[model samples]
Target: MPKLKLDIASKVLRLANPLRVAGYTFETWEVIVVTLDDGARRGRGEASGIYFLGDDAANMRAAIEDVRAAVEGGLDREALRSLLPPGGARNAIDCALWELEAARSGKPVWQLAGVPQPRPVVTTFTLSADTPIEMARGAVGYVDARAIKIKLTGDLALDLQRVHAIRAARPDVWLGVDGNQGFVRDQLDALIPALVEQRVSLLEQPLARGEEAALEGLASPIPIAGDESIVSLADVTAAPSQFQIVNIKLDKCGGLTEGLLMAAEARRLGLGVMVGTMIGTSLATAPGFVLAQLCDFVDLDGATFIVEDRLPSVAYRDGTVFAGPDVWGSGRP
Candidate 1:
């Protein structure tokens, strides 16, 4: 093995439309790209950190630089777990390692992870938090989507109206709501019933972190998913008691290596798995697609928000994402 060479670059991806969620609105995706060269083969990865979690492209790049010497000395994935805490930096390096291994061994990442062959996955098209009328209009464009994830801002009346409007517009689409940790326990009393009325099948992170205990014994019409509540393995152990689903984003739990472990642990705890993504290009979403194969819900539509994606990008159509073989790490055995 030759000394590994690393290159990092940042890009700003403009969204086709501004996306308003719980506490923030995003018009651009700031991402950091990592490329690792091992004398012969070169592999690449991308990461867009969670801004609310205090992660940014600059810090992610610096974190990667902190591990430069170890990576150049041929550090493996297992050692990577102890080297970095879970975040965007580990996510980029871990994914780049997977791509590097695939390039060297000629095996797909799915095969290396002991997962079955990859296939087209039905993904949730997201509706950014907007007025009732605007959300309804957004639903019209995704009338053919199998599932839709709607963002909520914890306002009882406005949120209810938004869901009702979208429900009325797309009666055939399965609905899931993400509060983004914007709601409180008191709001669930009124919000739960309204969500049920709208036929919402899943609810994500209704209450903020540290408030998960409020959901310990509470029962509702829809299964609750843990997004902000769960990040690393420790959070997974506590998730089953609070949520029925766990939203696993590669950047949140480290990378595909940790994500696979988290999914298995979530299943062992009898929790459904949801593979999600931060707003990024196809390069960022491609690795998450592998984990979506094992998830109950696939939320890998991050690339859809961007106006343009990296060349030879993942193909998304009719709500399904197809990872083309030409893309790095998407190969088959």
Candidate 2:
């Protein structure tokens, strides 16, 4: 089969609202979109902000341009990896291949990759960190939400207390906390118990990445998911003690192709899977919805933080994401 050509484009889509996390504030969502053209059909893929990996709109655009000449002439996914380091650029290309392949083969991205159709998955509504009262108020505002994922920097004592306050305010809501690499092993003794008592369902990347070995042989009351720690399939097996579940993001794992591989490998290693996304418009979150199907927790609500969204945004009805294959193109198997 003759190889298809790849054309890449990127832009900084200004955020409709400010997206606040512990260490970052995004006024705009930068995204890179790759389209693989076979002259008759086109496959599209998109990626959002990946600050942890030193990726922004400019770098991702340059990364795509760095490989465009070779890609235009026809380069496979593996070959493209050599031209680009693993980050948003590789992610876009890898996903483009999946979508392109799916389009050419007349299969949905899931069917092409042997993944089943996505079921109706419930997502975690994130309550951004702020003043204790404000945080508590946010939790209260989401009173009807099925589950809540609280964002926290270190400050274990205060954060735990805030959780208690939130729980006190809404006793029936399901709760999870994302430490975002804000805790040390020493703090776990105090932190884990507090989170557990509050009935926290999951704890995410409490410790920094590459510090996984520190958690060896330690046990906690709640499940620990790896967000910053697991970026590739290789990282999946490196730390057994550090994480019980893995958070897969396309921007981190190079793209949907390897993102799928990492998820499979993490599962093989007995790690639970969570699909997450960087803050952006629906374009960024759309491709990530595919991962949500196989994951236990879905955190693709990045766009929800934004005030406005691109046209034909992925529909979010009662916290459930509904996007058809053609909405984002079924990446090739």
- Estimate TM-scores for all models: 0.98, 0.91
| Deviation (Å) of 38 in candidate 1 | 0.7
The Cα error of candidate 1 at residue 257, in Å, is 0.3
Q: Pick by lDDT: which candidate is best?
A: 1
Model 1: residues >4 Å from true position, as ranges?
A: 331-333
Query: Which 10 consecutive residues of model 2 have the lowest summed lDDT?
Result: 324-333
Off by over 4 Å in 2: 1-5, 81-83, 330-333
Clashes of 1: 0
Q: For this target, which candidate reaches the highest TM-score against the unseen true structure?
A: 1
Q: 306 in model 2: Cα distance from truth in Å?
A: 1.8
